[model samples]
Target chain A: MTDTVHSDSAPPNGALPGTGDENVTGDEKMWTARVRRAAMRTLPPDKLLPDRQPSYVASWIYVFGVLTIAALVVIIASGVVLTWKGPSWWHVSKVGLFFNSIHLWSVELFFFFMVIHLWGKFFMAAWRGRRRATWVTGVVCFVVSIGAAFTGYISQQNFDSQWIATQAKDGLNSVGIGAFFNVLNFGQMLLWHVLLLPAVVIAFVGLHILLVRRRGVVHPFPARARPARHRITGAATVPDEALPSSEIETVLHKDPEPVR
Target chain B: MIDVVSASIVNLTHPGHYLHWGFIQLSLANSIVILAMLAVFVLALVLPFRSGRRSRR
Candidate 1:
């Protein structure tokens, strides 16, 4: 309930009482100590896993956010299996083929839900309430995911991969970036697809979700049923002077409820 | 016996050779990918978002 820990309740100088670490150091300069403090302040456990949410958050439009996360989990699980078995295994083994299919389908779902989420946020003006970082990070994640998908197509080691690489190389060369991003290089593409791009994507996704947790969900648009207007000294105005005042008060006082 | 087993396993594992749809031609692998994508789209459309009692705080 309280933001600051009281000195009277502070644990013994050399141990973290609540953490159950008997040999903990109380040094302020410790890197792990600083990180823990920062994480606790920025993303408290209650915010990370909420039990209730604003009433307006129950809309169908919000579902795509969780759907995208679900698809990402499936993609990562299948990707791990693919990495363990290697590229050629999928083409030869039924088990590998099944996993490969799961990966492909999951990617498709991920993009589908992600696009819907992006559009929903755009229409909702999700950057309102100083949440620009959340919106920007989400957009960056989407852009990087495209690169991940491109590298994946090139690393498939099949006819489609061969054709895509050959076709993409010319485009890359025309832009004069082919010297660095050689689409024809299978090994390079494989590394980017499996390791580099995914890392970047995961990092951005983590930041995006963290920002969302910090900012809470944006409120729904105010109700549009305006009161009837009447002529007031040659100027038409709504009769209720308290409406805008009430709206401002609601916006100022409302806190986001925990997610259900 | 080894030959028969190998043939049967290949038949089970191999995605068909080609898929022709009027103006379109796709390898079996590509066809499978396309089918999977379609299935995902359908799932997105039909999947329910809410479960149990839908009370709000």
Candidate 2:
């Protein structure tokens, strides 16, 4: 690879480098460079982590996503401690039980905040303005989180878990994924609960957030919140005095296009 | 053994505080949670947020 780097750095035709050896334009010779270029193109530092959010972001509805993320952080942290102590320790040890309780409530609040966020975004048409991918990812993450939480239930190492697993096994088998995802197996379920599902959830969540930052939050319905216009006679389209105070504030604090 | 925290108000472990509508039967706790979530969602939409700070941009 090193030998080809200098030789193939500048190919005759400037084809995309990742498209195989056929397109090794000067900068694309190295995979690192290609990756760097792609990352820079897709998520320049500002887009990936912008310092300023659009003014429309100032809403309690907007905070739910952040709250959901916060709950997930607590869930993961408490889950780590619970895993370190092992499952049965929670039944006998106070500290383990405390962490276990924290994990449970955090999971509940996570779902709670996430569902509210989903509702808020749905009513607002979050898929608007080329954000369908972000919307889809958020929905997929919700489904994956359900799976993660289900596994946590049946992996709890109690009669409750046992009953849940027993009842769930037949339904899973009917779907033909039982062998692949055996709910009755405590160890398997625990591993999945702590490892596999969390990884998928986190990865999808990261993608969802990056897409949000990339495309920007969806705007309000165009009809409902059109920018106040001005007429040729120097009169306002919607008189400033006629509008409600709150609506006026929303209109006056216009923001730059988030899609940029 | 009992949970003082949850049982103090009502015996949460005992079932029967539920709403039954046709084929749908939901526990009071779940119904309350769903109602609370809906309420919060509405409040988030309607409440005035603190946007007093001017945009630095």
Candidate 3:
């Protein structure tokens, strides 16, 4: 009796909405589908409010998003400490040196998580649901992150900085931005990396998350039995060759049986 | 009295070894403060998510 009740709460075909199946016969399946549809309808896409909580592309990989945010928080805190002591504090105090080291490590971790997060989003094809703005904002944030890292490296008062600055200047010159943003100026780089770039990065990240919460997760690419036209945006087909394997395996409505 | 005054001025001008020692001490101090902070950060990230499911119930 409970089995039937549970099944009823499930969607038709026992598949979740956006999981690709369109038809079902079991009463439980129908009930579940109705519930799911109801939940989706409640979320209005017009203002960036999603009706459902975002699910993971997979459970194992979900924590990395939190980890990335955590790392950023660390970077900011360490940066504050280092800044509090002042740039020359490193030369004058033992504690200052340690803070600098921590700051360095935090930045490294931040990049590690940032790269993984970007890749995860792309593979999920999360740019759907009129989320092109989110996608573009993320890409811009990525570019800014690179800038922040570059300026940070230049600010490090070491031989590596000296060599990188001279080498990097040429590349920057070719683009014409170098003429204005001199990489060699320690004072300028320090201020930009510590203050200006962080503000930009944080703002963009906040906006990206707002959109994610609004649209919910991108539906998994359709399964073989389902036509791509059934998706939210049927304007273009995700070519058989174009679909990423991980997404295909995870998202398709087919039973968990081996694809082989 | 003249000699003592001259010696004091010289010592003030060249507080030689003490200055280098101060820089090293500052670096060590910075490291300790950062390590403690990093530990707290790691804990915060790990604990909240682990406990979130249980707390939601």
Candidate 4:
């Protein structure tokens, strides 16, 4: 049997692609119209449905994530400076020393807020719905982040760096990982730390944000149903906004009445 | 022959530093910080799934 391919490059049934006519004779015409509409809806007033705003926005605890991202930006800028001079310059030159200091401080700040961001997200229980993939991706990123930081620390030509590299290898070898990752290999470790690991981390972070935007933030806990007596009594019900702040206390000391 | 040569090369180049006590202290501190961060990261990742499942339950 011979196969006949339909090639209708022109608008079908004399209908323009934008018109989205049912009688559009070609598959391309149909798909083009749909895709166009999708693109259009993704822009401005006729946009795709708006997702719900996070319920935790007012809390100061949320600031750590933004701070972590800010520190990462600094890290990237300082890293670019070091990359321009090459790794060896930082050990000798004054300008290099300044940039190195800035990079070190940036890493410290990044780790500080990153830890906070991770913890805050966890306690907030932000990973609800079909969000396990986001969580898993984030976990993988965390592992990668550790590797990046390790390689980064060793890449510094300081006494600390030299000592750590030699010492850490023993532990790694005992665990059977040293066969693949030789900490003493400066060239390989430098590239992996500075370029490869950061690239992977950034990619994971991008995916995490996309998934979050798609799914929307989880709501705070539902209101507790009061007992008839409590409703009758002067015992006022706590507001939903107080949920996250008081979660620790509430978990530690069970309320005499059921929470929900 | 190769093993003997490589061993000799190592002996000549070696700095002969045992994992110094200072380095051990630094590593321990770093490991604690890193471990805490790891726990937090795992918790953050797992939170969504846990809440999702909890709601279903």
Ranking of models by TM-score: 2, 1, 4, 3
Scored by TM-score, the top model is 2
In candidate 2, which residue pairs clash? A9-A26
Return the lDDT, model 2, position A9: 62
Where model 2 places Cα greater than 4 Å from the true spot, the runs are A1-28, A224-260, B1-3, B10-13
Off by over 4 Å in 3: A1-58, A226-260, B1-57
Best by lDDT: 2
Please give the clash total of every predicted structure, in order: 2, 1, 25, 2
Q: Which of the two candidates, 2 or 3, achieves a greater TM-score against the reference?
A: 2
Chain A TM-score for each candidate, in the given order? 0.80, 0.77, 0.64, 0.69
Tens-digit lDDT track of model 4 for A1-260: 22333444654553444444323354435567667656554343321244223223434334566677788889889998998897679878768877987998898878777767767667767675556776777677678888988999999877789899999999899999997899988888888988999999889877766655555444444345544322211134444443453553344233233211
TM-score of 3: 0.55
Q: Best candidate per DockQ, number?
A: 2
For model 2, state the Cα shift of residue A90 in Å: 0.8
Model 1, span A89-136: residue lDDT tens: 998888887898899889988987887778678878989777899999
Each candidate's DockQ: 0.11, 0.39, 0.02, 0.06
